[model samples]
Target: MGGDCESNVENIIEVKNLKKTYISRGHVTEALRGISFAVKKGEIFGILGVNGAGKSTTLNITIGLLTPSSGTVRIFGKNFFQHESELKNQMNIATAYADLAGNLTVYRNLKIYALMYNVPNYKKKIADLLESFGISHLADKWVGDLSAGEKTRVNLCKSLINDPELLLLDEPTASLDPSIASHVRRLILKLQKDRNMTVVFTSHNMPEVEEMCDRVALLHKGKVYMVDTPDSLVKIHTAPDLEEVFIRLAKGELEE
Candidate 1:
């Protein structure tokens, strides 16, 4: 939370006064309300909130999968809407529950994604990623043949195939055992440090957020309640840990 000055920091993602609303069969829902934030280069940012807290809506807008009702989203200083197709190449997204082609082998699925991203030397890159994630032995096996955790690792490797400048992950460690989850977290931190990558991910895992994220935004009811480092938030709330801080904020026990 306490890093370089905002003026000196290099921002990778700049979202200003973002708003989104959805209308379905006579019911209108305002998903986001004037949310504004920025993510700096080589930073791991976390988004935390309860269900219907507008976390997904904000992410969807940032990734260009959905349009905001108002405000702006800029990636690398260019408007996301105007430079979407070009900007997409510089960024990639991954989810823990990613559904890879069931019939395709891990290598084949990775090849397909690499082709889509127009990755150069894709074969070597894929091999490296598989080895880095400790899933190289499963490359020739069908996706359906792998266990749940194996598939998650494969999906994570796929996301990094392009060596994207930015990575958006949604629950990247969900459903994994504690050991594997810890390993994945370390891998992400290493990648961010080595590649100077900027990452924004949503997670309900408090300890993971505390351990991995450089800063965090707590959103509620379509608005960002606070943005700061996990440790700073815990200290400000005088809570013993981030989980307790989150609980206090989520339950409206803390006045924003």
Candidate 2:
């Protein structure tokens, strides 16, 4: 029971000069600084950055989980700060930081999340998502008892229970083994393809970014250093590939 996103899909998420700051002990930490971007429908947009590069800050702001100290974040051309209730239904996020209830079983976690979203056919939806992520057996297991990888998959499944139009993922495969990580990528691609979902993901995995993202934004020192396809960025920045681009960019060798 999903709405016709295409009929209303006009740039799912937009960030204009976004910035966030934290003040601790009178010291200002600028998390994001004047970042601007547009996330289009039916494409996997990746935010590539190292730790503390403002990628997490940006995602947090866009998902209505954090407020920007400056600038604007517009979803479906509507500001989440002004129209949160409507925006929350249109988007869903799966980040490790947004940890689910630990005392709940995997199935219970999914069930409650689906109910919270008011997803019709909630049970069937949960079942399908659980199967897709290969986490059906853990349905009855307590979330606190599952391994990190299992919890990650369960979190992913919970995100998909509602089949959101704009899905924001933060380091989705960061803790998985290589085989499971690839499987997770394949599953995410399949979901995007099947539902024409617009996705924005952040990751440090260069090859994974190359393999999954249609376009990528490299965040450096709290700002967007570059934005382009993997191949184009590599050609312009690093002759070989994304990994090279990452290394060169991080080293400040790939200017412009």
Candidate 3:
């Protein structure tokens, strides 16, 4: 196996033989079954799978929010568990499920996170994010008053407040209108290129995955079925697009 080979020395993320099991109410659930993958630095990698396929489970493990029953997650050449605190300082996570303080104003909420991250020139940064996201008018508005789309923008802004080297996103555009979702996609691309940030995200939106991701991992029932570029997967599966590729994989029709 290519375990910890120098070939992966340049990778920003290296997960090998990862496994997670949960025991609940006298029942056992195996969320991951020895999945392995590596993400390169400055690359936008995607984790694609249907619900309960272990995409979220894998992401949670990568971000150190959950522990694995076996295997290793290495970030920047260091074991994740051993270097979690230090590494997390350079990483951030954003989800469509907003984690903001509902009672606080948008500005207040972002300000608190900015302070936590010790962002430089935070006021200017906050103003820029508000303007960029077209949420300047909502700055003083209570977060609870914002719409789903608006809250998503706010959550995105908070994720970037730290200017993290690595960013994790969970269904960022879920439930968003096409226009707003398009804007968010463009913004993410710009951020990735401008800052050379490493991004790993989970999405069921195949078109979005095809357009934005440099590489994708297809997971099914807690195992990675395949990992490749969108075009490559399409070519391999002889499908029109990623959606079809996913469908075939789900049906157990794709062969080695």
Give the winner by lDDT: 3
Q: What is the lDDT of residue 110 in candidate 2?
A: 88
What C-alpha lDDT, on a 0 to 100 scale, does residue 82 get in candidate 1? 95
Give the range of the ten consecutive residues with the poorest summed lDDT in model 1: 1-10
- Candidate 1 lDDT score at position 160: 93
Models 1 onward score TM values of 0.93, 0.94, 0.94
Off by over 4 Å in 1: 1-9
**Candidate 2, which segments miss by more than 4 Å at Cα?**
1-9
Order of the predicted models by lDDT, top scorer first: 3, 1, 2
lDDT of 2 by residue, 190-212 (tens): 98999999999998888999999
By TM-score, the better pick of 2 and 3 is: 3
Q: Model 2: clashing residue pairs?
A: none
1 versus 2: better lDDT goes to: 1
Q: Against the unseen true structure, what C-alpha lDDT does each candidate score?
A: 0.87, 0.84, 0.88
Model 3 vs. true fold: TM: 0.94
Highest-scoring model, TM-score: 3
